[model samples]
Target: MSELPAGLVEFLESAGWGGAAIDPIPGDASFRRYFRVRHGARQAMLMHAPPPHEDPAPFLLVAQWLTNNGMRAPEIYAQNPREGWVLTEDFGNDRMRDWLDDNPDAEVSAYAGAIDALVALHRLDPGPFSPYDLAAYQREAALLTEWYCPAVGLSVDEEGYRAAWDEVLSPMLARQQPGVTVLRDYHAENIMLLGDPREGAPQGLIDFQDALVGHAAYDLVSLLQDARRDVAPELERAMLDRYIAACAPGPEFEADYARLGAQRNAKIVGIFTRLYKRDGKPRYLELIPRVWALMERDLAHPALAPVARWFDANIPDELRASGGGTIA
Candidate 1:
């Protein structure tokens, strides 16, 4: 078991919730760590984000944004900004992936709710209340290069990658789909199954510290072109259609979707590579082929042919091959 940081026990006690049994939760790629504490009938989750590497402000801000917008994210019970620790309502471990594994038919319905949540976020007025802005979008997109490229022992052709990114993004940005408070990681794993029968509102949402202001299609690609799970083609198409119809993106919808999918998948390929080589998480490697397949399909679209040709000529076969197996 990972060691709990010193003073965590004391911190919990000071929060007025003593006598609670604490269990360490697994760590993710970020500097943040999670813990579960049980105190009689009441339970809460504790987040330990060490200084410099992690900050609790974005989580707090976005949690407020999502909750205010009618989503069922964790409610912050108590917090200590000095230590970067937060106590929040427990959302449970039954994520949407596990729930769908048992009841396959519920996949469409559950995912529909997720898409609905996305639509709600998109439709909400971004007045003084919304915190999303342009800088955050660029930062999140840059992570694809920062985290993923070096892990494969491959350097991105900086000039080529930028040119390709611009070629694909320019037109979509021109039409500028109005920005929203995008929950950058709106995939199945982040969503939770709430009640025992598991048929009501979703209970949890995690890994949202990187929220951004960007295109409507960005989060959709993150959901449909998932690295951790295989979203069915029919379901993916249905969700795409649902978003298009719900948002009424015009003639450029298909083109924007195709272009954004390629951009997002390329970033993901780099990310998955980094996860295996740098982060010591080889399990993500298995998802590379699926991500590549998404890229291939997106590239096949007439709108993205130029970017497709560039990838085929520039990205080495050996590097792509390495994505399927252990990084070495």
Candidate 2:
């Protein structure tokens, strides 16, 4: 039995499941922890977000918003925001990756469902979320130099990197048409496959606490260009086509998607490196190469020309991936 936090124990007791068996679920990069609780015939998942490090308000608000929007987010059974704990419906251990692994033939349908969910989400208004505007995008893109460059013993002109990114991203962000809510981490791991294919919300969304207002294609980039898993190129193109046809976003959508994809992957590269150097999680280092590849692919788009030039000048092909901090 893993040690439960003091507040979590109290919250579970107040929720009438004090003595329930707690099975710790594997966590991601965030500070939030999940546990599957079973008492009698009832089962529920407890989300414990330690205060000062994390909060449950955004998760609760976004979950409610997604549910209200007719998409399937977890149902909050009970919540103690002050204590940073919430009990939500456990949609089982069937992750979208599970379905994709178990039934390879259903990849097309599964991705289609995800894209359709995004289309539905994009149509709704971004209630009170922060916009992923120019400053926000540039700040996130800076992570590459902030963490990754120094970790690999490579020198980066931080000012140059920022200037190049600004040149490309400023106009893109300024021209962004609002309305879509960009779920910051809309990848396979956070998406759960639930219910029948023909039914409502075949995809159950989680880890959307950081949802923000941004381009409709932002989440699409997050989904198709996942850092942890491989989404085949064919599926990527098909889903992009599906979204374009359904939304009719305009001719600039593809360019924006590619640009965001580059920006997002660059952020991930730094984040993964930071996870190892700062957070003491070395496993994320292995994914650095894959993320670099995705970044390269996205930079092929003309919209990312300036950003690509910065990378070519600073981070060479050999220095792209981490050397376990041994390259001096």
- All candidates: CA RMSD in angstroms? 3.0, 2.0
Candidate 2 lDDT at 306 equals 89
lDDT by residue (tens digit), candidate 1, 1-328: 2477877888888888888889988876577888999989999999998778788888888888778878777999888867889999998888888888888877788888778778877788642234333333334445556765555455666566566666666667756445666676878888877853335565467777777666777788888878778998899999988988899968987887788787777767767777777777877777888887887788889888777766667667665555433346
Clash count for each candidate, listed in order shown: 1, 0
Which portions of model 1 show Cα errors greater than 4 Å? Answer: 127-156, 196-200, 317-326
For each candidate in the order shown, give its overall lDDT on alpha carbons. Answer: 0.74, 0.85
lDDT of 2 at 56: 95
lDDT of 1 at 69: 76
TM-scores, all models, native as reference:
0.88, 0.95
Please provide, for model 2 over 96-169, each residue's C-alpha lDDT reduced to its tens digit, 9 standing for 90 to 100.
87767887877888889999988888888875798888888888999988888887778878998888888887
